[model samples]
Target: MTFPTPSSLVFRQLFESESSTFTYLIADRTHPNEAVLIDPVDSTVERDAKLIKELGLGLKFGLNTHCHADHITGTNLLRAKFPSMKSAISENAGSKADVLLKDNQTIEVGQFVLECRATPGHTDGCMSFLLKDQQQNPLAVFTGDALLIRGCGRTDFQQGSAASLYNSVHTRLFSLPDNVSVYPAHDYRGFTSSTIGEEKVHNPRLSKSADEFKTIMDNLNLPKPKLIDVAVPANINCGVH
Candidate 1:
């Protein structure tokens, strides 16, 4: 479903099928060509770069929500392609990045600003980016793996904690306005996006009591990610080869 956006906002959600990852490109159309890319995948950096160039956008930052274990991030490659662009990640993630973001830290892309919210539990350093309009009304949130459409990131690895994830979502994310759009990093199912109100009611896992949520997470029995070993190490260094 399409979320209503301001006419001056340039937004694109690109997907990488192998990992089922969603990469977002956000920019201000009224500004002088500045843009930022969130949760970029290594395999799709070329495509992202081509699109940025074609759109005449000067990439300002390649940001990750956390250190991903399923796939390498495109931040390193993006920096290589666009020398002026910087790589950013949460400071708690213990990863190498040009900018180590803190909770509540704001990153500007021309006239637009993205506020980083510390939403760990999926990982020690997981973050969600909140984009607001000029008047400070919530527009959309890039939830990364912390929260998903009708689901959430598994709390089985990467310093995962069910209690922490539960708290993060309830306090940091659920508090947003009901109309704020939710954009997650990955989607195994066909869903693309959901709103805070929709997930609060329809999300099977997060909508349950905290104790129930933790119990469910502990028993998920999901298999290990295929690329954990390689992806984790590469991602720790900001996806450098």
Candidate 2:
């Protein structure tokens, strides 16, 4: 689902590079004042804070697609700022998230409705948020780290699995409209975003079928994140780790 002009909701994309993570803010016009921040960056809360104030929007929600390994998330911080704002994450992800988003669960706020997709494999409860207008046509998807522009997320971290990622991508994310704009959790090479169709045609990983993806992911070796050990435990414990 592609749109001709601005989307039904107002969305802003931000990139934080201590770990190269991408954060997004999605809001609708009717409640143009109520906004949602996704996979917020801990190191850049002040920057986000600045943007929120500049945009003159009240943060209504904060979400994490999954527990992060490279950088701490600002989910708790944002919730603290907006005491009533709900913090969302997948169930049993060992998170302090307040709203446990389940598969196919829908959230209606103002003119936008977001559908929760239980896209695990990157982690036990990794999720992707599917957005649409009142018509239910596909608009955008915030794919935390489950999918990237030309590459899929690494499956070597805690709770990470090559097989799980393949299924999550092949069946879950890939099923969306090929033209849907993808906003990923991070991009290693600095390219901002890409569509699923673009990835399918150009992504080295997606060029292979499911079976081929599993085999290649299994044999490939990737270096651990520079701060994985330090970032993850803290992320799980509200920055206490």
Candidate 3:
């Protein structure tokens, strides 16, 4: 599923089936040698590395939107494969990384610049990365788990707060232009992406009032993630342990 991206940018969305996680590969077409990978899964490092190498791209950063509990990150493994690559995550994520980012920070690779927005809900360190075109118009947003296709991430643990998530979506994410595409970290419903306008009107959870959203989240009764016990601790150390 390809979203409409600018001709100046090279983009690919890779999936890891075990966790249903989506890893994004983005680079400036003018500087294909420098590329960024977001939300890479540990098990698919080889696959990602091969793609990067095949494209003749020099992996610059292995970025995680938050400290994931469902799967270990591939940042460490990516660094091992591409020695110059750096691992990055939100400073508030309570995770170790080569670069600890903050809200509103910008990471530039060639002509592409990613604006980081702190959107904590599923976890205290969750972030969303926004890309803009030459005219400064928003192109797309990589929403780590704050907002999904039709639903949102579970806020039952890891300092998850339903109210906070609700506020983040309404204030930070929903504020973007309706045409801006939304790419989430994980999707269970086979959805690849959605538009801001689509989510605003159609999202079952986020479209509701704050109190109603909270009530819905509270009654979900979802099971704990299978990998939480091992994945969380390993991710804190950048997924090497």
Candidate 4:
């Protein structure tokens, strides 16, 4: 099925088998001429690029909300393909980006301008993108592992912290207009997304206080992700040396 996005954006979900990660490509629906790739994993980059070409959209930029631990980010590959395209990321990711993004930063993509919300928790530098329609209705927020549908990202790795995650969600994400949609970086069972209103009221993880959230998150007996050891270094170095 096709992905969900604001009325002025066209988004596609490309799955990477190695990590079950979803890479999204959003084009300005109004212009259909400008596009950006978000958290693109290396495995499916080529397939996604071909689709972008077929759609007749020019790749203008690529964004990595944060360093990924599940699969290699294809940012470098895409940057190479569209040499003029800027690789935009958080300012925290210094000395590497063609453009440094800051908290509450904004970027224009046709009729819609996505506002960056720095929701650090899953990783200290993690971020979420806020999409507003042409009329400026807050459409959705792309939570990059920091906030998931029913669950959240494990906090035992790279700049991850349970308390930080707790604050980030409640203060930064949950505080959004309930009508805003919640688009997570990953989800199992094919139920790819949820609305902020729904998550605030229904997410089991979000129901607890920060202290309780910390205690519970600290106890989760999750195993290290298979690709974490590989994907991280690759992503930190922009996919390669």
RMSD of 1: 0.9
Q: Which stretches of candidate 3 lie over 4 Å from their true place?
A: 1-3
lDDT string, candidate 2, 14-89, tens digits:
9897788889887776685568888898878888978887877778778888888888888777766667777777
Give residue 93's error in model 2 in angstroms.
1.8
Task: Let me know the TM-score candidate 4 reaches against the reference structure.
Answer: 0.92
Worst 10 residues of 2 by lDDT: 1-10
Write the residue-wise lDDT of candidate 4 on 50-161 in tens digits. Answer: 8988878878778887888877888888877777778777777432667778998888878877899888877878888887777777877788898888888888878788
Worst 10 residues of 1 by lDDT: 1-10
Rank candidates by TM-score, best first. 1, 3, 4, 2
Q: Which pairs of residues clash in candidate 3, taking residues 3 or more apart in a chain or in different chains?
A: none
Candidate 3 global Cα RMSD: 1.0
| lDDT of model 3 at position 57 | 88
Model 4 per-residue lDDT at 82: 76
lDDT of model number 3: 0.93
Q: Which stretches of candidate 4 lie over 4 Å from their true place?
A: 1-8
Each prediction's number of clashing residue pairs: 0, 0, 0, 0
Q: Identify the superior model by TM-score, candidate 2 or candidate 3.
A: 3
Q: Residue 236, candidate 3: how far off, in angstroms? A: 0.3
